[model samples]
Target: MELVSLNATHPDHGGKSFQKAASVVLHLLVIAALTYQIRGVARLPAHPHIDARILVPYAPGHTAVVHPPKPKIIRPKEEPKLAMKEPPPPPPPSSGGDPTGDADVELAMASFFPDPKPDLAALPHGTRGDIVIDIVIDQDGKVVDTQVDQGLGHGVDEAVLAVLQTWTFYPATKSGKPVPSKQRLLFHFERA
Candidate 1:
């Protein structure tokens, strides 16, 4: 019961042959710092130029010099000239009569009718006719343009041009100011 002595030598430590010569000088200073970092990474010049190419098996005429990659001219960016200030000369020719000349306009007074009658009950059970629309009212009385000019299909001319585009007219005049006329709406789609 007394065999314990791993090459026994210890004056407080510094002994097994000075710890085997300090572990062989710390393994030769870690192999001389790993051979000075592998000779400074083998003198450094190998970033990315390794063309050891030797693939020669397609022998018929040996044509592989392909170098078509130099067409990148791309040049279209010239757009910065916006000083246009000549649009103020077009609003002085509007004093009453030739508001684009509907030629003496004067017949557009059916004030507003958000939906003044056009449900003909979805017309189909007999669908009588008559849809004629030609509107164009606008001088600010809106009804800008309808044009159904006699349609009466079972859809009742698109429900009387969608109820005459929510009709809103009273702007037809010429010698008396507000112009822009032209109105001829007669929608009668009786479908009892």
Candidate 2:
């Protein structure tokens, strides 16, 4: 018999050639892939299945009704009203505080005692001192007796006494009876 070539010759024009070893490798990969596919299909279960789940809402068949109580009526009590009295007007600002030393005495506008020193022509303005005078008043509210307890210079004592003579006080009373009362008078003399 004539010698026949067993090698499969690959066509080549400066191209790659598939050797015998490379062709054997490709055939082995294709057979492995087909065999794995067939084995995977055979391992599956005989019947196909689908999972199912159900949800339902709750319903109340019966419920009792509730009613609120009615509100009660309230009435205010009758009260007798008394007549309102208006308070006396506030005292003038010129007068000094609590001069008579008696809170209950109603001196009104005619009250004595200066917050500032009174003017004295004999002495210079801004002369600072006080002249105390003991005043004795009869039941008639007239200055009956006068005595100087202390004196500030420049005849201020005489000037204060002169003013005291003209003053008419509310005669002091004890237990509703007019009584002779003596009160100390302070004459404050300050500069200007």
Each prediction's whole-model lDDT (CA): 0.65, 0.62
lDDT of 1 by residue, 105-140 (tens): 466688777644656666577768776778787777
**Candidate 2 similarity to native, TM-score:** 0.38
Residue ranges of candidate 2 with Cα displaced over 4 Å: 1-121, 124-126
Taking the tens digit of each residue's C-alpha lDDT, what string does model 2 give over 29-95? Answer: 8766544332112211333463322212223453323323355667659776889999999975542
Candidate 2: give the clashing pairs.
125-191, 125-192, 126-191, 126-192, 127-191
For candidate 2, give the lDDT of residue 154.
77
- Model 1, position 14: C-alpha lDDT score: 53
For model 2, the local distance difference test gives: 0.62
TM of each candidate vs. truth: 0.27, 0.38
**Model 1 TM-score (2 dp):** 0.27
- In terms of TM-score, which candidate is strongest? 2
Alpha-carbon RMSD of each model: 16.7, 25.5
> What is the lDDT for 20 in model 1?
90
